[model samples]
Target: MPLLRTNTADKFIVDRRKTHRNSDVSRAVKHTRDRLSQRSGSPAFDRELLKLHARAIVTGASAIPLLVLVIAAAGLLGGMGGTILSWALVTVTCYTGIALFARSIDKADTARIELAATKRNFLILHSLSGLCWAYLASLGCGECQVEQFPVIKAVVLLLAMAATAIIASSLRGALVATFAAPVIVYGVVGARYWMPVEATMIGLLAISLPFFAYVAGHLNRSALMLLSFRREKDGLIAELETAKSMSDEARRRAEEANLAKSRFLASMSHELRTPLNAILGFSEVMSNEVLGQIQNTTYKEYARDIHDSGRHLLDLINEILDLSRIEAGRYQLNEEPVSLLDVVEECCHLMELRARNKDLRIVQQFEASLPRLFADERAIRQIALNLISNAVKFTPAGGEIVVKVGWTAGGGQYVSVADDGPGIPPDEIPVVLSAFGQGSIAIKSAEQGTGLGLPIVQGLLAMHGGEFQLNSKLREGTEAIAIFPRGRVMEDMPALPTLPLRAVASGGRRR
Candidate 1:
């Protein structure tokens, strides 16, 4: 419930509630639909579509048997490879029927392989019927004992051939799974020779009827199941997409509100600063005797209160402005040639009054040979001032604060600000660098701040393609090392005009 963060928090809560409601409703609907689909034995597939496939399987099966028998009869008459050729044709017909039936049955939620086998099984009965025919027709009058083959001498031989075909079919596919081997074994032995050609062939077909029926029924059921689920799947996907669009719109509105919040902070802060500075400035002048003081201690006390209140308000305003500038992406730095020595001297000078007030000693060691860093002078000063101020604010009275400037091993210069402050633990380092947070040491130190200074320094450093690091211990000291690339800070040198003191003080950021 922080002021700036309140709107985002509210939106997040609302979004969560909406998401939960949608999820609950979707779950309930899916559960009901799924239960209904499972309980109803109603065909999920289109009746017309499944009927089309059943028609094809039954029709082709009935037709192919006759053609294969004729072909096998031709083999018996004069063709040597007639049986094999007929078998191949029957196999080819089975495969073709499976391929065509697969497309039609597959429109439903049925298992593809099982349906394919069902179609093939429907066709396989054709070959068996043909085998029965060949054996029966070969028993022509029993006069021609073709090749001295006894089984081929009578119409009664149909049973033996039929049993052989059934056993062969049991070699693979669902037939092996559905029919018992012992049944084929017993049928071939005792019951095979007990019938004439016509009776034996017809009986063989009757025995295969049950297996054929099971395959057909399963194929129909699978196709219907697939179709039913297909409809449900499409419906669920559409619902999900609609929900996603709603969630995206809500997110977009939340972002717009956040942007508006950033704008409000920016405008209000700038306006507040104009009057805040006047209050602090005139208070300073009166306290310094630049304005004649009234001869009363009460008046002096009131002036002190006014000065303190104004300064505190100014600090709050500055934090808001810097944070808002970063949020709005308008925090541009002024690039100029800056001497490292000068930057260190200026930051130290600014922090000296604050340091002396707390009896803290800030020791600076400036390198004379430090090169001119090409970057924003204002940013460098801000970074240095914030770091030095942090160092002074955290270091205990009578402890040392060491500020050192030199070139790093790389071309970039290194400015290290160290202090014998109550230091940050390794785990707490990242927490301090986070926006709106401070180090454990800083929080417990003599001065309090808005927890913005380090983040501002880090942001300004990133603008220059520079880097910074911190090294410290729990009780020893903390060191902030800043590295700026060695080049002209301003590569695109726009002609800069010399500014008067009042304009510089008014416009350029002082802290």
Candidate 2:
């Protein structure tokens, strides 16, 4: 017993060839999609946020040192020059250290940085800077006759808080870490004086710190949202590139496989046909007793069977080669002006004998005086023959097959073959049109076919810039139409002008 029947073996081979490659591609796409769908707080996203924070700090590094210098210059007018200058040097040095640390972080690879440890170090540095500012806020100039000195100090702190909020927005809690101590210290020193102006300045400092921190939190959320968008965009681009590469590979492989198949068929055609021709000729001669008389009746029947089967196999091979050449774009058309009505009529006549043998009626309906079509005569004949032959093969005894040749609605020529037979199911039309694909009716029927007829017809029509349509319904009938475009319809040319005999003679004498 065979493990696989012929058709089953063919199907198994095709599926096995396709399954592994298709599954691998689908798995890769699914993995990419899942990886990209991770939430915003994933480690990758956190690293991106840290990198943004480091960059922001480096960008605004000079602002703090400049502000300290300006404050120190203002303090000289209040006769507290030495105290302010000394404080300025300390503040500037602290800010320079913080800036250097931030720059180092920005230049280093994000993958090497530990997020928790980096955040902790940044907060510690910011708290130290806060202490330096707190000391400045506590200083006073009572003997210098600068009446608005307390207000000036409060205004400077407010400016510093606002700047910190903007610069450190990407890192959560950074603004609060840098300004919380300063606000507390300023409020404490003002409480000692207990004057109305001092109380007001302290109240403003306390209120402004939380306000700036709230703004910084909002800015941090915005930064995270922006980073998420950037990450998603990059993921989408990567997915597209992967899909494109897979598509290109599949197409290239398909082209190579097609080329290999074409070459095998081209080389094997001659080899196969040589033996088939000898078999067919010998079988026919033996069946007819051309050389000698046969003794047994069984021998004669076997010879006839060999001839018939050989003929069928040869036809199948020819059909396969024709379809293959058409698919590979190697089938060149021998084009000419051919009559649509005449070509279709000839095809109907050729199939009429088979129709008669099956007890089926073939009716021809051709339009009168149809224009000639500029097309490959052989291709057009094959189209008509395929359709008509299918009709004859499938139509039951006493059924009718109509072969119509006429004008299409698009001002083009068309050949339509319709049969009153057990029709194809609508869903199976596509299968019937595919190469080596047979419909259920064709498979179950006694008629033998290689299932290359309709596909070859379609490919040939396509080469001629035409279209083939199959319309069928179960238990109703089937109709196959081959339509030639209006461009292929040859128009009548104007008559050439006739010259008088005298003018012709004068031209000949001049020559």
Candidate 3:
């Protein structure tokens, strides 16, 4: 009978062990599913989430030593009984192992591990820690006569649960496992005692569980939101970087194309000029009858027309080349102290004949006390000529074209050309300022030009530390002002010497 009983007991123990293992496996599968269902994007995010809980596990390990000290001080286990001390030591050793495992996860190369495996390992370690804490709770204070000793034990259990809920809250599975095990053990001990105070304490602990779980859920959501926002910010920054890279490449290509165009024009300069010279010379000879008189009068008129057309085309080519050189940074200015008044007067005189031919009057206004401008003489003359020419060309027959040179309020000088012509529209100002972009009035007028004038003026003034402004109103008039900045204006004058220093010295010596 004894041998039969022994065999039966062995079979029962084996069955119980198999049942426990199966239950653990089922619980683990359920835990993994619950945790993964709320997974956010990115494997890196999951790794970070798991690492946070792992840190909590390590942090909670500190509670074991504190519990041992508390039990020793209070004599809760009858002056630290051998069984209780051994259990405490076992708990401490297990927790230390858990803490080291967590540290390894933190220090391990994240690149080598799969995301799913990392989470599984962390969860496994956490569940094992919860089991250890649960075992501590199950160590009933049955030997203690003091009723308050159970309360102390209860307090320690609840404190451990609270720590887990607060720290590992970002991962729900870890939070639930770490706290639930201790809670169940506490309930079992409370039921065995069946005292009013113990029941009341157990009820309070149970009620606190749901509240902490809710807090855990809320914390998890907040962390997920923050991670999402970080991902979005990173994506936006990457997109902006890519767009900037593309823009820089396009700009580089555009500059290369422009440079090639400039080089081609510079190389073909002689070829273009040779044919133009032949056209002009041959047309002039035919028109003048230098070799022989043309019998037909119509042929002589056509020859004159050809000569004029050739000269206009040649002038257009020269203007294009000059503007190209300026844009290419190859145009060198011959700087000097130039009389602004003289340059304006000469340009006005040159354009006066054109104004008179179109039945327009030229009006000049000069400030007598204007100072000399330190600038490129050729550039200043070109600036004045272009303005005066545009004013004369656009002004209506019998209209007045006013040219003014004066001192600015800031001790600088200015040249303005105002014409009584159809003005440019405000919206078209940018269009007119661009290269080869003509205005509506210019296109309709008989004196339409290549539209390079304003851009050239703007470029030239930029080189001189000056600015060009155009003010106009439809059907009223147009005024173009070129302003030289105060820095370029010669304000302080050097005192003139009555005689050379050497001459004065020689005269003094002779005396």
TM-score of each: 0.57, 0.86, 0.77
**Per-model tally of clashing residue pairs:** 9, 0, 0
User: What tens-digit string does per-residue lDDT give for candidate 1 at 1-511?
Assistant: 0011101111011334454456776685777487437522333332333344544444444443444455456545644454545554754465455445545553544433354355365446444434433433333323333442323322223332333233223122333322333234334532445455534544554465455445544554555565557657766776678668988999899899988887787677778888888988887777666767568877677777899989977886786677667655788877667787888888898888888887888888876666577778888888898889888878888777888887666556767888988888876776677676777667766576777787777777767877777777898888887777665332335678999999888887764
How do the residues 323-438 of candidate 2 rate in per-residue lDDT, one tens digit apiece? 87887788999999999888888888898899889998888888878878999998899888888888887888989998888887778888888898888885566677777888
Top candidate on TM-score is: 2
> Cα RMSD to native, each candidate?
13.0, 6.5, 20.7
lDDT of candidate 1 vs native?
Answer: 0.60
Best by lDDT: 2
Q: What is the number of residue pairs that collide in model 3?
A: 0
Evaluated at residue 443, the lDDT of candidate 2 is 82
TM-score of candidate 3 against the unseen true structure:
0.77
lDDT of 3: 0.76
Give the poorly placed runs of model 3, Cα more than 4 Å off: 1-125, 140-155, 191-204, 492-494, 497-511
For the record, the alpha-carbon RMSD of candidate 2 to the native fold, in angstroms, is 6.5
Q: Kindly indicate the candidate among 2 and 3 with the higher lDDT.
A: 2
